[model samples]
Target: MKPLLLLDVDGVLNPMGRPTIDYRRYRCTIGTEVYTVHLNPRHGRRLLDLALSTGSELVWATTWEHHANEWIAPRIGLPALPVITMGPGRPRSEHGEMFKTPHVAAYAGRRPFVWFDDQVWAEDEEYLRVSQGLRDFLLVHVDPRHGLTREHLGMAHEWLTLTGFSQGP
Candidate 1:
């Protein structure tokens, strides 16, 4: 099975706090609520390049859920991608992992995956370790202030390359 590249919108793509000049503000209307997001177009290209080189499929694993396709994808130059359905409410596991942890695991289904999120904690890592034994997975913690950086992508690239999941030089 092809490896997966799991993406989160809030911190990973639409970074919170102050943003750099490279990021552009966008107005997204989800129902009656309007949300402003900061996005860097270059991130889209970089993510696509990384995925292509790694032979990985990008899947959204965020609270935005299907809305990511509507608001996040186009501005970032990505096409429609699969999204991991989040369970209702903000449920925490006994391990204290975030609600998205179990859902991401079920969606990944033993496939090697690279997950980008700011909320990932040690607890999440521990949970994944016990749940997905021997599966190659990389959980990249993207800082909400900086969003996704070249350095972050580099880490993923290096990991994928080392794991024999990358098809590029």
Candidate 2:
């Protein structure tokens, strides 16, 4: 099975506050909230290339849900990939982990995955560590202010290489 590269939009692709150069600003309306998002189109190509090189699949694991496919994918130049649904009502985690943790674990099942999110916490890490049928997962904590950067992608590439998930050297 191909490994998964999970992406979060708000804090991973669309950064918080004003972004530096190379980012284009867009106004997006999700529900009643009018959000100002900074997105770099290059990020889409980089992520797609990473997935291709690693033989992995890109998946949306954000609160945006199906909306990500509508609003995010086109902006980033990514095709409509799979989304990991949080289900109706978006239940919170009963455990100390982040609300998305349980849902992500359920979607990933036994497949190796790399998750990028700004809200990943120690509790989430511990929860995944002890969870049954889990292996070779990487939790990448992205700074909400900066969003994703080349260094982050480099780290992911390194992880894929070190973990032997890369399609080739």
For each of the candidates, give the backbone clash count.
0, 0
Using TM-score, give the best candidate's number: 1
In order, candidate lDDTs are: 0.88, 0.87
Per-residue lDDT of 53 in model 2: 82
lDDT of 2 at 97: 85
Q: What ranges in model 1 sit over 4 Å off?
A: 132-134, 167-169
C-alpha RMSD values across all candidates:
1.4, 1.6
Task: Report the C-alpha lDDT of model 1 over 77-144, residue by residue, as the tens digit.
Answer: 99999999996777767778888998988898888889999999888888888865536789999998
The TM-scores, one per candidate, come to 0.95, 0.93
Q: After superposition, how far is residue 37 of candidate 1 from its true place, in Å?
A: 0.5
Q: Assess candidate 1 and give its lDDT.
A: 0.88
